[model samples]
Target: MASWDVIVIGSGAGGAPVAERLAAAGMNVLVLERGKRFTKAQFEDRDEIEWCRRDRFVPSILTDPHTRRADEAAKAMPTTDGWISSILGGGTIHMSGFFLRARPEDTKLGSRLKEQGTTGHSAVDWAVPFDDIARYYPTVEDEMGVSGIAGGKLAPLAEHPMANRAEATAKKLGLPIERTPRAILTAARPDDDRAACAYRLVCASYGCPNDARGSMLVTYLRRGEKSGKVTVWTEALVTKLEKAGPDRVSGVRVKRLDNGGVEETVTAGVVVLACGAIESARLLLLSGEGFNPGGNVGKNLWFSLYVDVNAWFPKATMPEVMTGSPFIHRSLMVGGALKADEQKTLGLDRAGMLDLLWQHDNPIHRAERLAIEGGGTLWGRALKERIKQHFTEGRSMLCEGFGESIPHAGAYVDLDPATKDQHGLPVARLTYAHHPRDRKVAEHLAKTGLAILKDMGGQNAFVRVGIGETLILQGGTTRFGDEAKDSVTSPAGLVHGLKNLYVTDGGVLPSSMTAPGTLTIVANALRVAAGIVKQAGAARP
Candidate 1:
């Protein structure tokens, strides 16, 4: 058994910053991760079966299952397709590194939406505003080595440049474009011995070969370890958080995965749960009593809005074969996607993004997508001939869009009634469904994306919607509010009743955004860590 000043329950976008901050303050910080850690050498090029399909970043369903259903009345079934990365650096390592921020309108979405009379669930303004959160954006961007373009300042935006292809395409199509702020390194860094991007041109579900992707493993966590005040126990599954005497947290019970079923406990003065949205709430629900009396632990579970479009341009028309959109990935928000009158007809409340990219080169990935397009198996000669013609002759491009999922009454997560993991702990049951407005937003984004593709002179166009395309960008399970009765935590990030317990992960993000919440989660985590430092100082006798 060991003791520390703080115990952090994850090592992803949310947890890494806090752990590093607390450790840099010279506090004894312990981080517990429930997954395997991959070294730099192990991350080779294109092993989709192991990294993408298998339980590399995500856990396998057979051992750790989650039940999913549309609502309470429907029969829940097992689903392992959700994007829950359980590796050392969590989703950060596998993310495409799109570091977009939520706007002021997004922060006040709940109230604005309320005034619009669109109430499907608990949509409200965030306790913290965009300006308040803006203070840490540059710090994170610099530290994470985000590479953006020059000179395109919109409201609540810095002078970031737009990618050439996206900018050019948008101009031709009469669409507004924004530069994608990615956590990918544009140049080699001498400090970390990490090189610049080789432009291998792959981002989705693949680990970086050059460390250009600013994962926590290569950034904050690296800095935190250098402080010598932090310790991380990887592959250590935390089952229950223990309460010693009164109502205070005493220690955490953990099961070691590498060793043969070794169980241990670590005492801590404070506990930070940054284990993503799903597991964070599930862990809280599993905790015994005083720590969770209000039964508000796992409410309001939701996912991000998503749509995908694919088109193939003829080689004869375009002439040269287009490789990939490496540096300049471009995106744009549908301008009037959220006006009250416009939304009344569309049933949507927020803007959506459409990112244009060159078609991927991975054979396995292509095969999988082809299967989906054909609606059946296409093997032997038919598949070979298509591959030959496409690779050597045709050019392809993809336009993917994402909107916010409107949180509703029926969508939530809880402990499964009978299902348990290998550790004998209850698995998380996800009750998720898109609101009517959310579906409308997805439909519009998909249609608009398809229209853009057709305008670009593409053939054999296709689109996909709400088929687990955005399950990875999930949150809203443990949202904070102005009052304790209705929320799980304070605006400052502490649990309602448990003063020392803080949820610094995406779970605490009260509202969903048009983009991925990883960047916001990291920024808010820095805020939470700062508050923790102040409170710790006040307690020092």
Candidate 2:
């Protein structure tokens, strides 16, 4: 049996920073990962099949015999949507490197829901404001070595750096578009000897080949190892959290996933579970004795539904390839919420597809032209001629709607009684729903998407096909709040009843922010680690 000052589980966007900071502070930190350690060399030049289809850079869900059903009607079927990585780096390895900081208004998600005439959602606002985390954002960016132009014209308060090419395009268009802030490193650190981002452009839901994309494996884990204060145990699947006393977590019980034969117990003074939204809540629920007396542990899970628009052009594909997705038009993200009945009546439940032909990198204008011309069908040579004409006309653009999902109490994660991992512990089961306001957000975003394309010169521009929502973007399981009555986590990410326990992950999101959730998750860990360092110094004095 080995004991340490702190034990952090899961090494993705959340756990890595905390472990690195704690180890640097001289605390004996042990990090346990359920997957193999991957390096940058393994991710280079892989095609969509190896990368996206096989999830070579992402984590995988355990396919144990017993899977949980989302509802009673679907009881016989096991869920495949609780998709998470089983690899060492976790979801960060396969994350789309598109990054943005949540806006100030994002902190008041609950208030917005109420204003939209929503009543049944359980989503709550964040305890801290965006300004409080502002300083910490730079720290994470520096640590991860992000690349971009700072304070560009896209979003006024988007103070992070912007991509160079994106900035150029936005400037050329004289549109509200601007370069996006990215997690990938663009320069070298005077303190460390790691490589910078190469701008591979394949950052669409896949790992970066170079160490540039700021994956946790390169930044935090590598730095933690260099400090020699942290010990990493790979292939150790944590099954149970053992409690020493009523308020203290003593250690974790883990088993080897490969053999299912080896069993070990590693004790620690503190336990930080960052396994993710689904697994973290499941573990706490399985820990049994009073983890969530308020029953808010796994209650409020939300996911963003994605709607993407693609375009084609007559010119060479080279120019369009160069721009990459830079401008995030967020003005359409807000509108009065729509009821579920309205959504159903509007026929907004499935994914739809649309095509626009114009000059390469100018789909926005063509989309506007299409909207004006109603629509026309083309065949073979005629289609080729039309594409050439559109290309010369300089009209075309790709617009998408990434909508928010309001948190609901009915959405939750529970331990499956029948299914168990290799350690013989219960498997995690998740249940989520897009509440009325969440659907309305999607509808509004769709309408705004069309408007943006039309404004750009699209004649027959329209929303992408399908119900315009996706269940992949998850958040808010271990929500942070000022009062213990409302959330499982304190503002600092420490569990309410437990002193040494801390969590800094997607699960701790207090509200569904307007930006992609990873940046905030990493930034919050940095803030929490700083607090830990300050507390440790006080204890020494």
Candidate 3:
């Protein structure tokens, strides 16, 4: 077996950057992705009915079962809400491409929680400061070809025509609404392989046909391939990390999806697991009981506490009908520690943000809206009438809100003994109980979301919050902290007590920052890559 200098698992937002940076530094790197690789040609299939309704983009829970329960006493049932892409680029392939940066107050979240007398998980504050992490923001943007404003760190984006409805609404209400920072290209660039946004209506949960969206597949991973030092093996499912000796991961055992369950082992001097928060934690647990002594590997899993408010307006209410754009043109952030002046109204102290989108991107989701509005049946004249009203006279607008899930010890992931995947490995089971504060904040935000729609002259508003809404936004599994006993990884994202093993993913986020999580995930991945490069240099003998 050919041993590599670095082995990075899951070539998505997290792993791709690390692999690319290492490979560019002339390290022999191997990237293992569980899903099949698809170029821009494969992205043309925008089948809303098949892909959205069926489990085409997502894997079946039966094969890769992730059971969920509110608490330890409740029996866990298999849930499809644990939806994430198993494709080569992971969730980035189908992302809406919002790039919201975290604020200073967000970095010191643990202190805020303590000040408020709440019990958050072990590593609530980041080991590194906001400045340390924010330093890499520019690199991530330029490398990925994110278009907005000056195109530098913390810079704003040039406004899009899609923002017309939102801008008009925000202006009418006298609310401060700025252009959203997006990874999708608005202008052509020499460095980028992707074209500008084709204005394709099917952006949400669908791969970009124009390659305009700066997914890691077309951005970082492609850069790694061009470096000629990076080798990617697709459909290679990593089962377990093999430990060589005390505090060292020797190699990884992988099963091939296409080649008739053929299994193989590959050696590496260092292993970086970036299979996302849930799956990465699952794989670490599967490595063996001894791999995680403190039980911090899968603990503290949390999602953005979220809710959506959709309301319709008459066609005459706006200049023209919006053909569905997911760009959240307007946003209002509810910071973790409430400002003294604002505390009187918001009640509890917590972190949250509200986003405004034009309408539902997929027609199938519109049908779902019809069910929620028209009641149970999919086939009826009333359903048709409702759908027609939404498109013509009553065009809809959305105000989506997200609050931070107060990371606690009770919410976690563990291996399910009863359920196993096609590979016969025990699946990841989640025990998630929402923090009382999170539920409270979400309820408050639901009210606030309705207020936003009403401000935009929305009649017949619909608001949804509470359970089953926020499961899609997950984080904080392999969290990093200063103390070895409390956290899984270091501030640099290396696992505690393990020298050659590291994690470069959202799993290392110390706390939940209420925004789109991908921008931070990418920035940290770059920071981790810099650390590895420094390590490799230090060890040069």
Candidate 4:
């Protein structure tokens, strides 16, 4: 059996930072990833079918299926909804890189709900205050080469021609809008070998061929390898965590995907699970009952609620819409705390942010939408004419609103009793139903966004609420808290009953904030690494 001081599973934003920190601290670290390690040359292709339509990033749902339902009463059906990337750097490899920080109020959601007299929700304040994690944000930004102003953290990329007009419109309407910070590099740095952004505009679901986006594969994983103490095993799936005693994880059992059904047991002094929220929770439940003393292993799973509002502008009115620049780069965060009237009318606690961006440029997606709108019968000359009009007549702007989904008793994940994977292991089953207040918050934000688009001279401004959960930003399954009775992990990210088992992913987050959870996950991973290093040093003597 191969042994190491620490074994970190899943080299995403969460695992990579901790692995790099531990290796830099002179501890031998092993990282096991379930996906293949593709080189920069492999990611250079720009095929929409390979990157977006196919199962290159995510697993094939037909084989490794997950079942989902609105509630426990309904029979769960097979779905591909919650799968993020199963690659070397996980979802960060194909992310849009909207690196926004969580507001201070987001850290103390339990206190905010209590103050507002909100009931029947499972929201909890973080074990540590936001300031404890704030100090690590700059480290993440600096290492990832985030491009933005120092104090304001908002620098608009000059590639987008529509930014000036959007800013002017927001200012005229007395709405507060700020430029968003992205993880993509604006200029080539001195020490880094990666190139600057090419403004290709096919960012969200496509891998960056130029390495401009600061994915963990190109950043922390590379740094960890340079430390000479970190070893990464790609295409390795950890199936179970073996226990040393009542409160210690001895090692992990791994299955090699590249090999033909080869399995091995590897020992480690410590184990860290960073396989995002869904898979991390599934692994714990599969390991047995020893790690579930609190019975809180797979509970309180929450996903960010997404509300999309789109508006169309004619080419004659807004000529900038036809400029072919996909960067809008603006966000509306003016609705901070809810006013007295808003609270009374909407029955909500707070408001969320509205991110403005140009509509996706996928031709297939646009054609499908047109086909659906034309009753699925638009073909031949009509379809060609519609496609031309869709491109030349006008362009659509999208305002994506991200709101907090309050964790409730109804939303969670567990092992499916009937559905098993190709390896005969039980698959993860998700039971989710949005809180009623989630729709209200989303609707409020959508209305605000719609008004902004109309103010900007948008012709067909409309709002679409309750577009379901944003699975990529999920969290709270193994939430960390001060007490073991309610949370699966401690404030330092250690599992409740295990001394050496930790979770350094979004699963340890207690609440899903209004913004993306990637930055917070990275910052918290650094904080957890510090705690582990300090503990290791104290035990050395």
Please state every model's RMSD to the true fold in angstroms. 3.2, 7.4, 2.5, 1.9
Candidate 2's displacement at residue 278, Å, is 0.9
Model 3 residue runs over 4 Å out of place are 120-123, 149-175, 323-328, 334-341, 374-379, 466-469
Off by over 4 Å in 4: 150-156, 339-341, 373-380
Query: Which regions of candidate 1 are displaced past 4 Å?
Result: 149-165, 324-328, 334-349, 466-469
Candidate 1 clashes between residue pairs 3 or more apart in a chain or in different chains: 149-161, 150-161
The lDDT for every candidate, in the order shown, is 0.77, 0.64, 0.77, 0.84
Across 1-541, the per-residue lDDT of candidate 4 in tens digits comes to: 8999999999998899999999999899999999889888877877878877889988888988889988988998988777778899988898988788887888888888888777788889998778888789888987987775346343445546677777887788666777777888877754666887788856778778888888998888988987789899999999999999998999999999889769999999989999989999999999996877588887999998788888888888777788755678887763346667777898676878788887788878777666665246787888889888887888878888888888988989999999998888898999999877787788788888888888777877777454567898989999999888889999898999789999999989988888877888999999999999999999997
Mind giving the per-residue lDDT tens digits that candidate 1 earns over 5-102? 99999999989999999998879999999988787777765776777767778777888878788888888787784546898888998888888877
The best candidate by TM-score is 4
Give one digit per residue, the lDDT tens place, for model 3 in 227-301: 898899988999999988888889999888878878889999989999888889999999984567477888888
**All candidates' TM-scores?**
0.93, 0.78, 0.94, 0.96
Q: Which candidate model has the greater lDDT, 3 or 4?
A: 4
**Residue 22 Cα positional deviation in candidate 3, in Å, after optimal superposition:** 0.2
Which of candidates 2 and 4 reaches a greater lDDT? 4
Local error of candidate 2 at residue 101 (angstroms): 1.2
